[model samples]
Target: MSSPFIVVPTYHELENLPRFTEQLWTALPQARLLLVDDASGDGTPDWVKSHLLYQKQLFLLERAGKQGLGSAYVAGFSWVTAHLPTMEPCTAVVQMDADLSHNPDAIKDLLGALDAGADLVLATRYRGGVRVTNWPLRRLLLSLGAAQYVKLITGMPFSDPTGGFKAFRPEKLGELDLEQIHSDGYAFQIEVTHMAWRLGWNISEVPITFEDRAAGVSKMSTRIVREAVWRVPWMALHRRRLKPRTESAFAQKRSSS
Candidate 1:
């Protein structure tokens, strides 16, 4: 009876967890959520175990200490692939933040994109002219600049490669070396999207209105930014060396022959 799982990476998000589950269920009642918490010492684990554990669709993975966003998702994906029995109509994995910044209502759009033959659907803030709300000018510029920089380096045309709101087909996701993804924070988002593109998944960017979190403090830090700054170029170089031979490339080569 397993189903498509939504991997939500949480860290000290006690206040947002309740509303997150509520809104998410209201939107997609049948969807399963895997809350990967990185030792949020604020009783997040206890609350989820007490209130949500009984639900057949809700699950949690508790880790010791803040183990970066990339690893949390890698763990969640591995767990789902290992433990969950794939059923009909369950073809994709979702990744989103626990904070309300990413609208729960948009989950349908993302999944719909997957159903419409998209291997990877990215909920982009820059798709339809900067669809973000409440972000200060400086932060907005940083995000936009980062996306542009990623595009220039990785040669991926995604408008929001750094965006966290995305859906991926399990088949497409399985092609990636998940354990090899070690970038933290926004860098992880970029790396995953680039990896999917390199794997030749049909990546579609859907416009989403990203709002600032209403309840919790932001997690953006100099360290995370520094990591992305250093790692993105290196990823570009690595991608150049180990370019995945996608089906399209193979078909083109055969046709030319």
Candidate 2:
């Protein structure tokens, strides 16, 4: 199997970047990382450019301003897809946070699930039980409630639908019309996974221990939460428009055979 590419979106994350990259590289030395910075004035881009290791293993995408997390990820994935043929090919495109909230050590479990034939692997904090660490009670409750709300609104059965830690097959990631994903914040997570599920992709979940970020402040805002609140049901109402990509590919294969 080829190495995976990790996409991390950052804004004012300088305090956490060094340690995060150290642990990430230690865990998956072969993997390459793409850090999409929304012009974080905290010397983030400068740090990336100056780091010796980053010269080969890490790539930076500097945006003009604070674009939302969803758009940053879309841009990163699109970069990977466009360059994979010319650059070193990767087996998967993994998306995670830069604040050390998503553990790098658990990345192997996600990749292992992909090797086992899952088209998309979600690093879940609620599969068997809640596995979050160092989070306040109210925040934990909010996250749990959001998961339940997503399932109730969208009829998607996956636990932790809003979790950002996930791995995607390169081809499947490439097939997505990134322009159609207009959501930001939690809604973006739900929308992408919902699209894959609707397309009959083989989705699976792996339990992971999610931790609160060790450094820097969170980027969450009331606006983001409000967006998710109204977007969930909208996605459900439009589910009929999604055609199963897997079934279409299978049909083509059968016809050829």
Candidate 3:
């Protein structure tokens, strides 16, 4: 019985993978996990195979060289869709950080929001007085500022539009014009939401506390941020000129109740 897939992209996260795998199953015991690791030279694939907890539940795809986060996710997404073509009760696809910044427990809330009818559920860090640990004030400001800029330029409703943790109903996402996603950096999140918005699908957010990675270096680079900032506005101005494979209507749910 194939179930929903949670696509996690990894670089040299061998040390973090085992913990993440354990946390994932605890929160989503039934969901399949697709971990796509770029050639991390850290023996990530081998490490995965050695983990007993994974058994038949975890799957890994290794690429020859380092690829951007966007490419890793795209590959993982394709693999899940192909392998679980007839997954009986239907499936949802999730993209999230492997660094533990996006808590695994929060996945339940995101899924709950989707079950309540959101086409896409973003695990937002800005909602309520949600806590984020170990982040310097400077980093927090820049991240929030970036999200605000994306929202103003793209007209997306969610405050955490730049957040990496999100889920999409597979059928709705499969029907998406996947090729329309051009930016493969931090903007990847924005591009997808923009696509969903253009398709007129229901999108909403759930609050999640984000923590800094307990180990390993952050992949966030200035270049990636610059790429996102430039690309988001450009797409906004040209959105009408582009055509997409049609699917759902972009409407918000009337009430949370």
Ranking by TM-score: 2, 1, 3
In the range 1-257, model 2's lDDT, one tens digit per residue, is: 46889999999999999999999989999888999999999999999999987747799988999989999988988777766665666877899999999999999999999999999999999999999999989888988999999999878899999999999977677556666888898999999999888878899999999999989999988888899999899888886467643432223433676
Ranking by lDDT, best first?
2, 1, 3
Please give the RMSD of candidate 2 to the true structure: 3.5
**TM-score for all models, in order of appearance:** 0.90, 0.93, 0.89
Give the C-alpha miss distance for residue 220 in model 1, angstroms. 1.3
Every candidate's lDDT = 0.82, 0.87, 0.78
lDDT of 1: 0.82
List candidate 2 segments past 4 Å from native: 244-257
User: What tens digits encode model 1's per-residue C-alpha lDDT throughout 43-153?
Assistant: 998888888543567788889999888899989887766654333335568999999999989988988899899988999999768888998999999999999999888
User: Residue-pair clashes per candidate, as listed?
Assistant: 0, 0, 3
Off by over 4 Å in 3: 53-55, 86-90, 241-257
Question: What value of lDDT does candidate 2 attain over all alpha carbons?
Answer: 0.87
